[model samples]
Target chain A: SQTIHQWPATLVQPVGSPLSLECTVEGTSNPNLYWYRQAAGRGLQLLFYSVGIGQISSEVPQNLSASRPQDRQFILSSKKLLLSDSGFYLCAWSPRQGVTDTQYFGPGTRLTVL
Target chain B: AQSVAQPEDQVNVAEGNPLTVKCTYSVSGNPYLFWYVQYPNRGLQFLLKYITGDNLVKGSYGFEAEFNKSQTSFHLKKPSALVSDSALYFCAVRDGRGTNAGKSTFGDGTTLTVKP
Candidate 1:
């Protein structure tokens, strides 16, 4: 059984501060990883996705960036956080190749930029 | 490119009644659709998916979705609604392209409220 872990379940940061969120998957190798953000009472917005190490595709241009340093380790970072950057960050993984590739998500992290 | 549309923002239904959350998608090739559920302050959970085969796909917690190619819709349905079923539901779609594309487009999401 594969599982995803995201750290800093909750964080409160002042505006203009740096941000770092980590995500890792166990029991699976070289899986596809993704980063998503959701505002309160709104839908999810895809930020970035990685198919392999050192490969990252950003969807919407924002104050955030994602990097897959290891096969199963993905990190989301920002030099300075904006007030709008505050939201729930989610990390998800899916099989590399399959007909129906469904994503499995982690517990997620809540970030509040005050 | 693919896109999904969840027409309703919120659905209100009484417990024990049949519930339906509408979803429609647009894709160039064959569409691989999925349904996910999320609780407050939690991540999205995979409920079910429709790749190929039966139009109706059953998923966790007795939730099901029917895929209609003609209508370009994949609506999530449940026989009987439960108060516990109150949460947010999302519809997603993937375009048929690379072996492991890894990018999925999602809809705005629908909020399901099952009242007792």
Candidate 2:
């Protein structure tokens, strides 16, 4: 079975500080990875998605960026964090083939920018 | 562009009663619909999906969804509601065509509160 891991589970950072969140998937190769943010009332918003290594498509223009360093490793980073950047970040993975593939989500990281 | 709409922001249901969370979708080509449940302080869990064939799809925790192509709706339903079922539900849709066909558009989400 495939499993997605993310850390740190919870984070607290001061404004303008750098941010880095890591996501890694085990038991799967060449999977489609995605980054999503869930905010109060706003729901789940897609931030970025990567099809392969070094290939990323951003859905929203923001301070955050995503990178796929290895086939199973994805990282979300920001040079500087904003107050609005605080939210529950989720990492998901889906099969490369099959149109009906369903995404599997990680435990998620709750970030609070003070 | 693909989009999903969850009309109700929140739904209240008593335990043991039938529950329904509405969802509608719009997409360019054939739409692949999915339902996910999110508990407090947790990530979203895949509940069910409607690919093709049966209109009624059964999923985890005894939950089901009915897909109506003409209505463009995939409503999640459960015959008996439980207090543990209180959580946020989301509906997502993805186009069956194009290179980025795996990309999905999610709804704003609906909060389901099952009262004891």
Candidate 3:
């Protein structure tokens, strides 16, 4: 069975600080990875998605960026964080690039920028 | 562009009563719909999906969803609600055209509260 793992389950960062969140998937190769943010009282917002190593597509433009350093490793980073950057971050993995494929999510990281 | 809409902000039901959470979607091609549940301070868990074939899809925890193509709706249902079932439900849809590589759009989510 495949499992997705995201680290720093809860984070508290001061304003203008750097941010890094990692996600890794085990038991699957070449899986589609995605990063999503859920603001307070809002739905999930797709931040970035990676198809392969060094390939990333960002949905909404902001201070955030994503990188696929390895086939099963994805990282979300920011040089300087903003107060608006605080939200619940989720990492998900899907089998392949087909509509029939279902996505499995990780435990998620809750970030609070003060 | 693809999008999903969960009309109800919140739903309340007794433990023994049936529960329904409404969902509707808009996509250019045939829609692949899915239902997910999120518990307090937890990640979203996949419940079920409707790709094709049967309109009625059964999922985890004795929950089911009926896909109405004409209505463009897929409503999640449970025959008998359990207090443990109380959580946030989300509906998502992906276009079947394979244009976006299985990229999915999600709804605002509906909160289900089952009283004991």
Candidate 4:
């Protein structure tokens, strides 16, 4: 069975500080990775998705960016964080071949920018 | 582009009563619909999906959804509601014939609250 892991289950950051969140999937190779953010009382917003290494697609242009450094490793980073950047960050993976495959989500990271 | 609409922002149901969370979708070609449940401050969990063949799809925790092509709806249903079923629910859609078939568009989400 495949498992997805996310680091820093919770984080508190000051404004203008740098941000980094990591996600990795074990037992799967060349999977499609995605980054999503959910604000309080709001729906999820897709931030980035990568079909392969070094290939990232931005669903929304914002202060945050994503990178797939390795086949199973994806990282979300920001040079300077904003108050609006505070939210629950989620990482998801889906099979590359299945068109209707469901996405598996990680435990998620809660970031609070003060 | 594919889009999903969850008309109700919140639904209230009593325990042991039948429950329904409505969802509708739009797409150019065939539509692949999905239902997910999210607990407080937790990630979304897949409940069920409608790919093809079956109009009614069963999923985890006694949840089910009926896919209606004519109505363009995939409404989540349960025979008997439980207080534990209170959570956030989301509907998603994917374009089956589009180039970005892997991409799914989600609705704003509906909050389901089952009273004890």
Candidate 5:
């Protein structure tokens, strides 16, 4: 079975610091990867998605960015963290070949900017 | 483009009672709808989806959703609510079979509280 992994699990950063969150999927190749942020534990804000390596589509223009350096590895980054950038970051993956497959999500990372 | 609406922000139900969380959507093409559940501080879990076929689709943890094309709704339902079922629920929709099929628009989400 396929599984998605994300780390540092939790992080605390001072304002204006650089940010990097990593995600990877095992047991699947060429999967569609996505990044989302949830604030106040409600609505999900889509950050970015990638269909393949070196291909990333950003949904919202913000302080954050995403890159898929490998087929099953996606990374979310920020040059300088903003107070508003603090939230729970979730990474998800879906079958690339499926027309409408449901996304499988990782444990997620909690980021707090102080 | 596709959109999803979850009208209620919160729902309160007693344990063992029937529960329902409402959802509606819009899409340019055929709609592929999905339901997800999230516990506190956790990632959303895929509950179920509707691509084609049965209007009433059963999902994980004894939950189900009714797909009504006429109503443009896909409300999540469970026959008997459990205290453990208390969590957040989300509805999502996407265009089927064409461009942007992989991308889905999500609702604001609903908080379900199953009290004992």
Candidate 6:
């Protein structure tokens, strides 16, 4: 079975500080990875998605960026964080590009930017 | 563009009673609908999805969803509610044309509370 792991289950960062969140998937190779943010436990806003290594497509334009350094390793980073960047960050992985594929999500990271 | 709507902001039901969480979607091509559940301070869990074939698709945790093409809706339903079912539910949709690999637009989410 495939499992997704995210680091720093909870994080507290000061404003303007750097941010880094890592997501790694085990038992799967060349999986599609995605980054999503949920605000106030409501709607989900897609941040970025990667189909392969070094390829990323961003949905929302903000201070956030994502990278796929390896086949199953994805990272979300920011040079400087904003107060609005505080939210629950979720990492998801799907088998392939087909829409029929169901996405599997990680435990998620809670970032509190003060 | 693809979008989904979960009309109800909240739903309340008693244990052992049937429950329904409504969902509707819009897309240029065929719609691929999905249901997910979220517990407090946790990540969303995949409940079920509607790709093709049966209009009534059964999913995890004894939940099912009916795909009504005419109505453009895929509402999640459960015959009996459990207190453990109380959580946040989300509906998502995307154009099944293979254009945007796994991109889906999610609904605002509905809070379901099942009382014993």
DockQ of 2: 0.78
TM-score of chain B of each: 0.96, 0.98, 0.97, 0.98, 0.97, 0.97
Per-residue lDDT for A1-114 in model 5, tens only?
A: 898999999999999999999999999999999999999788988899999999999999998999998999999999999999999999999999875899989999999999
Interface RMSD of 2: 1.0
**Model 4, A5-63: lDDT tens per residue?**
99889999999999999999999989999999998856888899999999999999898
Q: Compared with the true structure, what per-residue lDDT tens digits does model 3 show for residues B36-100? A: 99998788999999999999999999999999999999999999999999999999999987566
Model 5 agreement with the true structure over B1-116: per-residue lDDT tens digits: 78899999999999999999999998989999999999998999999999999999999999999999999999999999999999999999988856777988889999999999
TM-score of each: 0.97, 0.98, 0.98, 0.98, 0.98, 0.98
lDDT of 6: 0.94
What tens digits encode model 2's per-residue C-alpha lDDT throughout A7-101? 99999999999999999999999999999999874588999999899999999999999999999999999999999999999999999987689
Taking every candidate in turn, the Cα RMSD to the unseen true structure, in Å, is 1.4, 1.0, 0.9, 0.9, 0.9, 0.9
Count of clashes in candidate 1:
0
Deviation of model 6 at B55, angstroms: 0.2
User: Could you tell me which 10 consecutive residues in candidate 3 chain A have the lowest summed lDDT?
Assistant: A94-103
lDDT of 6 by residue, A1-108 (tens): 899999889999999999999999999888999999999999999999999999999998999999998999999999999999999999999988577888888999
Between the candidate structures 1 and 2, which one is better when assessed by TM-score? 2
lDDT of 1 at A58: 86
Question: Looking at model 6 chain B, which ten-residue stretch has the lowest summed lDDT?
Answer: B94-103
Off by over 4 Å in 5: none
**Any runs in candidate 1 off by more than 4 Å, and if so which?**
B98-100
Q: How does model 3 do on interface RMSD, in angstroms?
A: 1.1
Candidate 2 collision pairs:
none
- Give the least accurate 10-residue stretch of model 1 chain B, judged by summed lDDT: B95-104
Relative to the unseen true structure, what is the C-alpha lDDT of residue B78 in candidate 6, on a scale of 0 to 100?
Answer: 100
